[model samples]
Target: MSLRAIATFDVSTGGGVGHGLATWFGAALAGPLRGRLEQEQQGTAFFSASTRATERSPRQEYQPLATGWEAMRQELLHEPETAHVLYMREHLGKPLVHVRSSTIRVRRPNAEAQLLFGADCGSLDDVAFCAGAVEFLVAALDTVNPAFAWLGADAPASEETNLDWVLGRRVRDSVREARKLLRGYSWTTVCPEELSVRLGGPGALAATGAFHRVVPLSAGGCDPAGDRDRGGVHRRGRARCLRGPAPRPAARCPAVRPGPPGAALLPRGRVPLPRVTDRKREGARHADATARAVFSG
Candidate 1:
């Protein structure tokens, strides 16, 4: 049977302790996660579910998920990879305090691919940090990503799920109401980074190549070297033309034309990045039509 893949990422970094410390301040067990990214390939995970799922147990103690993201972010520091460690330190601002949770959907790979929800905290600096972070991320992932996680990151089943345990109380309430419609055991560890996760299988390998081609416009006046890397920078700032009345000196619109590899300028303004796949197509279709109608009316 086909399964819908859901992964949530949590990127929250504020305090190093609190009821949250069980998750956040928990230091990572000393030692690197062993193995480089390409060498490790992936973490060890079992792909089979031995326990048959049924209704969630009543009186099932519920753990408080302040942001739902904290649980996952901490886990990222643990386990393999010098590159990931360096990558986190480099971009996330060393001693990264930021937390981000994301989920990526890997479709039935034309090749071999599986959806796995993951969490990593950029704040982790020690072993205690790893201890807490691991359990939390594992909890969120096992609960949401059906393709990965047999337990832990997930609780067997709860009343369905929540994408955010914080900043999403309304959604959580609505989730409770929606529970009446779902059959089978509803896993409820709470998927937090639902929005930032990827969704596609090996089908997305195409995306890796294509994403590079999408080239972000240098609107913020990027460095000259950055321009060289991003392919010659395009005009910065907003545009008022493109299809409007006419070109006037007051019109801040810059022209767009085809150029050589390093100089190709896409239609000057903020080009709405194109949805190159079906998953992207779905995301593009989610605009608030009712709100749009009201605004237009």
Candidate 2:
């Protein structure tokens, strides 16, 4: 199984976002991640180049990571419709890490920039690598300061699956709703561990701040069900009565029947969810909202 960790954030269509991402990527490759990779005999140099896979010519020559990132940064700064996929591997057909980015465009308003780290865990060593990579990526969330993010075990096959499972909407509907809600909203810091605790373990986490909010979705609550009727579609329910002072009013809380082990739902407009789907086909999709009832009894 391939374990993946993703951090998605709201960024302007400015050159600074690209520059900041490039700088962070380079620093990660040369700093903390360097020692971890070295311990596994997969040093930073092993990821020497970036491979751009295409449909017509899925195979393309690789370029040094520095070169590829620099080129991507430039394109992100200058090109409004820039969409690129850069992945690293020991050789062709064996991907270890992936990074994709695109500038915000008018055509698709819900899109957000994402930094993903993944590794296929087939053996003990591979599991270790995946663990290390996930740890680094999750820790980097504080630095990246994403509006919303998630870490999962198996990657969803497509954007539709990701959206349906995470937000309980199809791609088109989700994007439209997100674009509408995203306006007049700002970004804030979301702590993953803290979110996990607040959600009562295994559900989407959303919290309000003075100006912004953060939501963290967990694997257990966000996993998809096999039954189509239950797949990514959550049913509304009343909160269970609890003793002591409630976080908020139970009557105000809107609850959803938590799915099996891979899906969670947040009330609409809780926080801006990143459209971290396929860029080539879908462009960019974003959604935003505040969850006032999420913390209710």
Candidate 3:
């Protein structure tokens, strides 16, 4: 089995699930995951849908967001139950990394948005990237303001059950390394079932100052043991909260190339570009992308 990590959020409030997804995507591309996704020359974003067969043949569905990021954002902002967005990095016609988001439906009362890594075509191994992604999601709690969120391998099951199916040595090592780097953070959980119960419902959890706030476990910092006793949750690690306003695209960011006529305007505030200062750094980034491709392959 391959290594996997999931971050689930209760995005039923605020702007609903679609808006939450848009916010999360923008933050991800503009923040920690920028180096991996923006620098690549070949990338594609698409919506997946199932088709029904008619008496004659199967009918095709016209997807507006299939064009690019600008269109995708527009749909996500307006649609209530939009198709999940899948992003892929391509090299020589082969896929390197695949990032996917959860789909929100109209009838679902309490919709949730989930960001998955290494669950589809790839296995997450970059410790730095994994840690950065987790940090970004935790910080995003303020803007997206999901009632409850947690990050860890698989779903909110017992640790033993979650890791029981692991058969490969490499996969095991990846899981262990991810835990080591992510432990001590309040949202990082080995078993989400226990945390959810302790935290109570979404309203109660949000009132605990855990959402939209970064509570680290350091000297004089928030205490997990004490928090647990007081009907709260805290881990034994230190992480800085991404304070202040949302980040804007730097001047050095790549200019949005003009698409064909009638194309939607790309949102400047959310666009993310690689910031390469020197040749050595560029080479290193490329090497990292290659390593990801190798691992996924």
| TM-score winner | 2
Error of 3 at 66 (Å): 11
State every prediction's TM-score relative to the real structure. 0.18, 0.45, 0.40
Q: Which candidate is the best by lDDT?
A: 2
lDDT of 3: 0.33
- Per-residue lDDT of model 2, residues 1-297, tens digit only: 343343333342122344434533554455334543443354333444322322233433335444455664454433223343434444444545554443233123223333444444232235345345434444444344333333344445233324443334454454344322221111112333322343343232221112112323232111111111111112232121111112333223222223225333333323333332332233223323222212210
Give lDDT per model, in order: 0.20, 0.34, 0.33
**Model 3 over residues 1-297: C-alpha lDDT tens digits?**
122233333333345655655676656555544554334433443233222222244533334322355555655464334234334443333222223443232123333344555444333444455455555554444444343344533333222112211111122232233212221122233212223333343344335443443343211112111122111222221111101111242223222222222222111222111122222422232221101000000
Positional deviation of residue 189's Cα in model 3 after best superposition, in angstroms: 5.5
Tens-digit lDDT track of model 1 for 98-200: 2211111111110011122223432222334333333443432322222111111222112222211111223233233221211111111111222112222
